[model samples]
Target: MATPNYGYEKRQKELAKKKKKEDKAREKAARKLNPSSPGLAQGDPETDVASLEHDAPTVPELPTKDG
Candidate 1:
């Protein structure tokens, strides 16, 4: 019969929590540094422009009399 290592498991859980917290802090710092990041849920100017261009309707050429 193997005994459960509760101490090791607790330490591992703590390390995971710490790592998650650190990663979240780093992400938040990055977002703060770059306000235009897509993660911020704000409209990006370049994205807006691209969407507008993509959605723009194309004009059809008229047939000329010589055609």
Candidate 2:
């Protein structure tokens, strides 16, 4: 079996963490540049506007014959 290199493993972990932090910063900057970019909203008007106006559906009444 090969011996473990504790120092090398620790450095590798630190490098990974640094890369992750840099990536998040870049993403935040990109979002700042495009504030109005199309994305998921709380609610979309075209698909949800009608449903919002109405509640429960009503059943049609049957007609009765008069004597």
Candidate 3:
């Protein structure tokens, strides 16, 4: 009878799949618990700049001379 050297390989793949499923479930539960989380939402910096267009000045960068 031949011994199975690839048994651990199969066990590792099964463990990886289980871990991924668990992580996804945890994320789903957290989002359900907190729908208005700041990290999950995107911020619009452009809107803020647009509101302050007259007060905000555009500065042009001067070319640097290499000695």
- Score every model by TM-score: 0.57, 0.52, 0.48
Name the candidate, 1 or 2, with the larger TM-score value: 1
What is the Cα-based TM-score of model 1?
0.57
lDDT of 3 by residue, 1-67 (tens): 9787798989999999999999999997887577456555423444333345556677998888972
lDDT of each: 0.77, 0.71, 0.71
Question: What is the per-residue lDDT of model 2 for residues 3-66, given as tens digits with 9 covering 90 to 100?
Answer: 9999999999999999999999998788656645465232555434345567466789888796
Give per-model CA RMSD.
10.1, 11.2, 8.7
lDDT of 2: 0.71
Best-to-worst order by TM-score is: 1, 2, 3
lDDT of 3 at 8: 93
Please tell me which model should have the higher lDDT, number 1 or number 3.
1
TM-score of candidate 2 versus the correct structure, residues matched by position: 0.52
